[model samples]
Target: MLRMNINNLIKIFFLLVILSIEIGQSLIPLDRYSTSSILIDKKLFFFGGETVHNLKPSTTLDQILYLDVSKPFNTVNPPFEELPNTIPFGSSYAIAFPSSQKNVIYLFGGITVNVNTDLDDFKSILHSYNLETNQWTIPTTSGIAPGRRREISGVINNNTGKFYAFGGLSDQFTGTPNNTIALNDMNIFDINTLAWSKGSTINAPLPRADYTATLLSNGIIVFIGGRETNAFRDVDINQLALYDTKVDKWSLMTARGVTMENRFLHSAVLTPDERIIIFGGRKVPNDDPVLNQLAVLNTKMTPYEWSIPQVPAIDNMPLTTSAHSATLVGNYMFINFGQITPITNPQIQLPFFYILDIRNFTWIIQFEPEKSTIDTTSVNKSPSNSTSNSPDLPVEKSDNGKQIGIILGTVGLSIGIGIVVGFLGYKYYKKQKYKHAIPTAGSPTI
Candidate 1:
């Protein structure tokens, strides 16, 4: 009877071990696209984008979703939580940044498109989201707000507490059609005074939207890769332009490394090492977009050269993604929610989040690579019939993420089971010894 009981316990324990492995495999979340994310107070905040199933009228997300970065990998319950107060307007393609003030972040300029007419009701409104208060407040400003625009990128000067807005589309292409003009004009918002002022644009980069701007340690805002026209056939600008806030001068930087792609809507982040890490974007839609690569600029160097590190296969980054938000936290860049391809398919949205370790160049997916339920509806865009002769890059093998997660989980669980088994065994032996010491029930008094 004792042998049978022990065998059954061992079998049940192994069964539980298998069940845990399965549960750990299902932790990864579905893919997301066309959203904005920011890291504030060690937490990642994601807002405003169309989900896979709810793409009709291009449903903009108002709910603020967040992930706690301090938790261990794959162990947090309630993977994402919604804030009590939502964004005033459900918008997509909006720019979000952390302000110099603690526990405060600013969101500006996103487009709400009409599904029936395919037009953008663009907004240039600025709303301050207080992480501490869990409230969104539209602070009144004195200066003229930039006219309705989308895809405009901005950087807040922490030193001056001023927000700078660069080139963006002033008018939606609906009314003017092909005559839509990209604004090269710069707008400044004084956070302290709550006023707006026009910044010097004497020699700014060509007026363009969908380009990225990053603030350098020397107070220069670097702009790169935006198209002159919305047409995919139109080549994107390749020059790396620099704007000096101190002198109010604009000039192009002469970079010396591998010829970087002239693409727009791509995201860039300033690494702790002072290098600008530019990831996936395309020169034109429908062409094989840049993939699984990092074009890094050594801004610390005199001439600012670009270098692509030879990372190992295990350290391979995720495949091509654009319109995504890459927020830096500690030593890792949390990249979640963005378009993975230039060509849109109603059925092809991947909503998973990834973490790129800046120190080791390894990629980690936060959730399982399962396809989430999304609107399998086609998005209307200016079509590009162009095809690329360049070879296709390798897709991300998500199995690696799954395998690594499983190994770690299995090891950790095994250690826990071993400890439990040893404890139970010792208890069982003690119980048997106590029974034997009873001296056949009646003889125990001796």
Candidate 2:
């Protein structure tokens, strides 16, 4: 009787375990989509740029926006709160990094409205906003200021508490109707020390501006193809490369896997799996064509490789435009902004967030965002990751926290239930055999 009770308990436990796993997977939205440079804290950050409306001959912008990146679709409020007007004029060349000791957001450089002129000109100063204080502090740099540049690629080196900026035009902005390629420089800024330094190319380096740079987990900074200055076209060079900060050397191993085409103002998301998820850059073919395609570059390989990532549909693809931004949550990617202009004037609207859930290999187009801003939509919630995907088999990260929890719970419950079920079965079989062997009442005991 005791054994039978144990067996029943075990069966119940197993069923419970399976149920738990299923529940976790079912409830959690495990995927994210993006068309922006991705950064994080407890929250996600992105600054919007001038779309068609503001892309006048010499337009400067004033909008800085961000999103939570972790909202569920059914959520009615949609949780995107526009932050208080912190910066006066909108600018795109802004880079955000956490301060040395405090949790304050240090937003430095790019372009902004000059208090006196209101012209969208190069901003040399830095602004530090305390998320806790809701105040802004402009800190001065001791060394030479990084010359003004736009669409420069930058990433905060977590190891050194410094920001390394690469590939941007010089402070020289020619007011030409078109054709400006003079601004090209790579530099590094020490966030802690507040110093500026320039980078010299080791080998044949691409002096390309408006390029994409993502910091890999291994501390290596991988750079992908970008646009050359006011040339209005992506560079002829489409190869990828990585700069090892420790060694201060560049590597040629960035040209492997699927070769990416030349694109500018494209967005790359470092998936939890360590693969760079890239999307929506205007492609400059021999014959220029606007692209609305998606791709992924695997930076884990020694020769960093790239290939087009698969999204669900062709009908509802992201509209072809640059100056847009994207963020990732779980396996899904959230893309927004980069105003659509038949001509460069500017009509602003929140493009409904497009989410790519990776678990079921599905893409969900959610249109019912309830907020004017996107502070709550584009979040990256991937777990600990490693690059083990071979050329053939691609490894995916935990679809989302909820999915992972469900899987673990299911496994636990299965074992728990299995123990009880096995025990009961054994006990019942033992009782049957014992009865068969009993001889005292006319059967011989074996």
Candidate 3:
């Protein structure tokens, strides 16, 4: 009978093992996706980005490659493929403004040249690509555009069909010392009417390049840190300002994370929660600018507040870097491809990739990877007539992130169970060992 009982337990254990393996087959996680690209509206897009080795120049790609993010995970699906090389300004920080002027993507000022030692090699021209046609077209409008610049932001008032941009570094004349014109001017492009209009300036407006300004859903434009125009030396500004589109007025808003660190060429992503997530930018020394600290702000509250829940997370040198591209797909934030200028070693921004899922926003260092949820109802955007390709989201950690997580979890759980089972067994064993040894009234002791 005892042998039969043991045989029954063994059969049950094997059956459960087979069932768990079957269940795991249906669980496909996001980390398994190997593409280092980001997704918007279920469409994944990526181009070659900044690499480390600063002294060596990098290439600027002109094609936009995409994959459908909403598809079910399958081993047979093709990954990201180029969507005809038509879009202009495939460089970093090209001012991707969605919900702007009937859903258009604008490519603006960024470095077309990486001469290493020279700061004069920035581009000033602005280009826009129509998503419907997959074509790049320059705006035919009027204004003294501070072209060949960087650190500019574009926001669209879709209701008015007006797309606006302000603040960048560009010298209008045959001059030196790039993108520092001290012009705190506003330029707006009317996509519906196809025209340009310069905005009136705020009183005592500070000149800033490498600063960040984002248009909120409430139609308020908020600008963050940049190099100030206080020419007396040893003075860099980290002030916050705002512009209201409805009222056409600009003002300052007090915010945290405005430390002396200059946050130029960094990215500010408005999360699904309406909080802005900032990523790598250079921290300038002694008022000499550039920084890599990322600061997120919860500006939804009156008297806006900044949040840097993940600071000094990247445990590498040049801790805060600039000219990197970062975006949020789902709950995770993707930061990759940027330039880094070390104090002595000529600027080299290595091609580093990071995946910051929303859960890790509280504990970023131990960023655990999660599996992708297979929602059959989700609409994926493959080419209309072609089978959707599955370009995977990069697994920023080791390929074993998922496997390691499972191992750790199983070990942790098994250890816990073992401790409980051992304690119970010890109680049972001791009960049997000393059951007859108890000092009871009826027991005889020798």
Candidate with best TM-score: 1
Candidate 3, poorest ten consecutive residues by summed lDDT:
27-36
Error of 2 at 359 (Å): 4.8
**TM-scores of the models, in the order given:** 0.69, 0.63, 0.58
Candidate 1 structure quality by residue, lDDT tens digits, 37-155: 88775467887775433423444555577865654454223255446676666666677877656898888876655544435543447778888888877777897887766777788
After superposing candidate 1, which stretches have Cα over 4 Å from the reference?
1-31, 55-57, 75-78, 99-102, 113-124, 172-179, 229-238, 285-287, 315-317, 345-347, 365-446
RMSD of each: 22.2, 22.3, 20.8
How are the candidates ranked when ordered by TM-score, highest leading?
Answer: 1, 2, 3
Highest lDDT against the true fold, candidate = 1
Candidate 2 Cα outliers beyond 4 Å, as residue runs: 1-41, 51-59, 74-78, 115-117, 120-122, 171-184, 229-233, 285-292, 314-316, 339-352, 358-361, 366-446
Separately for all candidates shown, the number of backbone clashes (residues 3 or more apart, or on different chains) is 15, 48, 25
lDDT per residue for candidate 3 within 1-446, as digits (tens), equals: 53454455556555555554333333211111111234455665653332221122333333355645454333222233345563333354446554344435556555444333333343446666666776667666565655565446666776888877776655456556433454477877776766667776855256666666677888888776655563112113245678888777887666655454545556677776678777665444432234435566787776777655643344432344455556665666655445433423332222344556554563232222233533455646775666457786666787477666656755665565555555455544533442333222221000
Q: Between candidates 1 and 3, which one is better according to TM-score?
A: 1
